[model samples]
Target chain A: MTDHIDQDRPGRGDGAAGDAHRAKPTSSAFEIILPALGERPAFEVGEAVSVRDRSPIGHYRVPIYLRGHVGTVVRIIEPVLVDNEAEGYGRNAGSRLHYYRVAFPLTELWSRYEGAPGDELHVEIFETWLERAQ
Target chain B: MTSVHTDHHDHDHDHAAIEQVDRPGYYEVMETAIRELLIAKGLISAGDIRHQIEVLDSRSPALGAAVVARAWTDPDFKRRLLADGRKGCEELGISFYDDTQLIVLENTSEVHNLIVCTLCSCYPRPVLGLPPDWYKLKPYRARAVSEPRKVLAEFGTHLPDDVEIRVSDSTAAVRYLVLPLRPEGTDDWSPDELAAIVTRDAMIGVIPVTIGGEAA
Candidate 1:
C-alpha cells in the first residue's frame, strides 16, 4: 500500500522544478564538506550503499536517473563544505563530507550499449544514495 | 532505374524491421516506472507528467525564437544582452533567477563560452527549456570542461586558435546558459519571423544561429 503512494505524484523526476519544491525551507546548522582528495576511504568494489532521503532541502545530485541502477565505486574525490540536502530545513545549518566519484558500466546502464569493457561512464554523485552492494 | 537489385529490398526491409524493435534503455524504463508509480500513488497525475514533458519539448524552440526576435528588432536589447544576459532576458519577460541564480554568458568573436555541469546535468530549463539527450551524456559533460575546444570541434564548432574558450561549470546551486550571437542578414525581419530559426542547440552555444536554418 505504501508503494502505491510513491507512484501518484506529479513531476517525480528531479530537475529545476522539482528542486524548487524540495529546497530546504531554511538553512541548516551544520556545514557540509566534500571529502578531501588522496584520503582513501574504504569501500569494496561492489558494495551496496544506501542513499539518504533528501526530500526536505530539495536539490540533490543523485538524480532519479540512477535510483535503482547499481554501479561500482570508481574514484574518491576531495571533500568541500556545502549544505546538507537531508537536513536542509528552515533555519537548520550543518555541513557534511561526501564522496564524489563512481563508475557505472555503460552496458549496465544501457543494455544495448556495444562499447568495449573499458568504456565506462564516470558520474560524480553525492554519497547519500549509495549503500553496500549485496 | 534499378535493373538488378533483387536482394536489396529484403535487406532494407530487414534493417527497418530490426530498427523498429530496438528496445528502450534502462533509464527509459526506469523513467516510465517512476512516472507510473507517482501517478498511482497520487503524488501527481499522469496528465501532469505528460504536461511537463510537453512543456520541455516545446520550451527550447520557444526560447530560441524569443532571443532571435529580440536580436533582430532591438539594437539596445542586443547590446544589453551582450553586456548582461540575465538582465537582457528579463526585459523580454524571460525569468532566469527565481529558484536558482542563473548566469548568462555571451559568445562573441573574441571569447566563446560553453556550459556543462560535470557533476550533474544542471541547466536553466526555465529560460532555454529542457536539455537535449546529448547534452546530458557523460562524454559531453566530461569533455566540455577539460577539452572544450576539441569537444566543440566534434559538434562542428571550431573556434580559431586566437579565440578564447570559456567553459562554465554548473553546480547544485548555480547554473549557466549561453546566449548565442545574433545571425547576420536579419536586419529587417520581424521578431516572430526571426524566432522561427532559433534552435535550442544554438542557444546552448553548441551551434550558431544560421540565417538560413539549422546548421548542416
Candidate 2:
C-alpha cells in the first residue's frame, strides 16, 4: 500500500528545486554551527539499529515499512540541510541531524518478498528516527 | 531501418483537410500569463528567467561523468570523493546550486548501488540534468523500493546472483550518485575517452559501463 496517491501532477525540470534551492540562507548557518557543536553520530557504520516507531500525522521521509524493523548503518552522510520537520514547511528553524544510510533486509520488510536471502534495501534515515537495537 | 505505414488511407484523399492539433494547454497559457504579469509588475525580469533557464540547460550527465572519470584516474581524488563528495565536486569547478549535500556511492565487485526518490523526485539536478519521465513515473518509484533487482532486470541490467544489491532511497535533501567500477581495458584510455563511455544510467547504477563498447 503506497501513500503517494496525490503525486499525479506531471511536469519535470525542477519546479520544486527552484523553490527550495538557495532560498534558505540558514544552510550556511548550519555549516558554521555543525563543526562548532562537534556532535558525533548516534550510530556507527555496520552497527545494528532499529527505526523508531513514532508515527507522526504530517509529512515525513521515513517509509511506513521501516517503522519497527532492525537495520545496519551502512554509511554516515555529512550533516547538511534541514530535516523533514523544516523541509516540509520551508522553514529553517530546526537543527541539522546526521543522516545515516541504513540497510534493511527485504524479507524483514515484506513477508512475501520474492528475492534471494541476500537481497536488501537501504533508506536514508535521520538520527532522530533511529534508536539502539534491542 | 524500414518505414512501416498503415494501408487504409487512400493516396488520393485530401491531405490539406487535416487539422492541426497542436495547442498549448490551460496551465501553459496560465504560466505564460503569470510570467508576463510578474515581468510587468517588476517583480522579476525576463533576463532573470532566461538566466535561470540557461543554468538548468547547462547541467547534464556529462558533468557527473567527468567527475567519475577524474576519480577513476586519480586515487587522491577518489579518496576525496569518498570522504567528501560536495567538496570533491567543487574541486573540479562544479558549482552547487543549493545546500543539499551530494553523496557518492562506489560500486565494487561485491556491492552495487541504486538510487531512487520515493517521496518526490528529489535528485542531484546540479550534476545530472532532469530525470527521465520513466524515473519520475509512479511504477518505477514504488517498484524500485520494493523489488530493486526486478527493476534492474527491467532496465536490462543483470548482476551476479552472489553480489549484493543495495538500493538507497533518496528520502531527504541528500542526493546520491553512483560511482560505477571502472571498466576493464581502459588502463591506457584518457579521462575524456573514459568519460564518453559513461552513461547516465551507469552513474544512476542501473547498468554498468562497457569497457571498449557503447553503453552497457
Candidate 3:
C-alpha cells in the first residue's frame, strides 16, 4: 500500500499530529496518588477535584487553562498502563494510574464566558494531575 | 494460540481502496524508509503493517450506528451501554484492538454533549471510523474548547437556552462516543431501520438524529 492520500482530506492523517503529545514527557515530577496502585482510587464520582496548578515543561494531556480549576468527578475511568510522563521518554514503567473525568463549569474556565451558566467542560484527567478540592 | 503469530485469514472483506490510494507523501516516504530499514534488520515484517492497515480500514461509523440503534430499541442493552461502554460494545460483537477505553456519553433533554480532541484528534476509531477533516483543524479544536456554543452553532446544532451544553475534550487514552438522544416518534422502528439515520456527525454530537426519513 502507498502512503499517498487525497490532499482534499488534509486533516485525514489519522491523528498522527496528536501522537507527539503522547510521546513527550512532562517536565514536572510525576504526581503521586494516595493508596498508589493496589488500592481504591483517590476520587469518587461527583467528588470535587482541583486540577494541580503546576506547569510542566514537556508533553502532557491536562489542558493548561484548566490547571488550578475545580471540577466534579464524573467517573473513575480505567487504569493507565503507562503513566504519560514516563511514556514521553519511551519508557514503559508498567505503572497503573487512576483516570477520572472531571467536569468544570465553563464560567469558571473562562473569564468572559457567554455560554449557558450551566455549560461545562468534561476532560479525562489522570489522577496525578488532581488534588482534593478544598 | 501458542504459535509465534497466528494468521487471521479474514480476507473476505474488499481491499480495493488499499490498492487505489497508493500515493506516498513525505511522511509516507519517511515511514517506508524506516519500515524498510527495520525489515532489512529483521525487526518487523511488511505483512504485519499491511495486516494492521487492513484491520483499521474495515472499521466504520456503521459499527457504531449499529450499537446506537440496538440501544435505542432495547432498554436492557441501553442500560448496559450507559453503565459500561467497552463491554457493551463487545456484547454487540464490536471490540477494539487498542488499549484506549471507550466511554459513551448520553445526551438528554436537559443536557447536551459535544466531543473534541483539543490536544490532538484522539477519536474513537474502532467504532466511528477516522475523524473527519474538520475535526482535526486547529480552529475547530481551539474554538471547541474555548467557545463550544459558537462552534456548535456553526455545525447547525443550536440547542435551547435552557439545555446545558457540555464539551468533552478527549485529551487522554479514554475515547468518547456521544450517545445522542434518540429522536422522537420512532418507537416502532426496527434496529436496522434506525441505524440508517444514525450519522457519524450525530454520534459525534455535532447534530441530532432526525425523526423522519431524512438521511444524515
- Per-residue accuracy of model 2 over B1-216 as CA lDDT, tens digit each: 223344447574433345445688999899999999999999999999999888888989999999999999999999999888889998988888866788899999988888888777877888888887877888988888788889898888887778888777888767889999999888999999989988898888888988655544
Q: How high is the lDDT of residue A88 in model 1?
A: 51
Clashing pairs in 3: A4-B23, A4-B24
Which candidate order results from sorting by DockQ in descending order?
Answer: 3, 2, 1
Write the residue-wise lDDT of candidate 2 on A68-92 in tens digits: 9999998887754457666667765
Q: Given candidate 3, what's the lDDT at residue B48? A: 87
The TM-scores that each candidate's chain B achieves against the reference are 0.69, 0.82, 0.84
Residue B91 lDDT (model 3): 93
Residue B47 shift from truth in candidate 2, angstroms: 3.8
Tens digit of lDDT per residue, candidate 3, span B1-216? 122323445665433332334467899899889999999998888898889888889889999999999988889999989888888998988878876788898999999889999888899998987889999999998888788889888877888779999899999788889898888888888999899988899888888899664533
Task: Report the Cα lDDT for candidate 3.
Answer: 0.81
Instruction: Supply candidate 1's per-residue lDDT for B25.
Output: 93
Q: Output the number of the TM-score-best candidate.
A: 3
lDDT of 1 by residue, B120-177 (tens): 6778786777788888999998766556666777888877756666555565544566
**Clashing pairs counted in every model:** 61, 0, 2
Superposition error at B200 for model 2 (Å): 0.3
lDDT of 3 by residue, A1-134 (tens): 34222122212112343344334543533321112242356677888889999977887898787999999998888644456666777875655667888999999999898898999999989877898899
lDDT of each: 0.59, 0.79, 0.81
Instruction: Grade the docking of candidate 1.
Output: incorrect
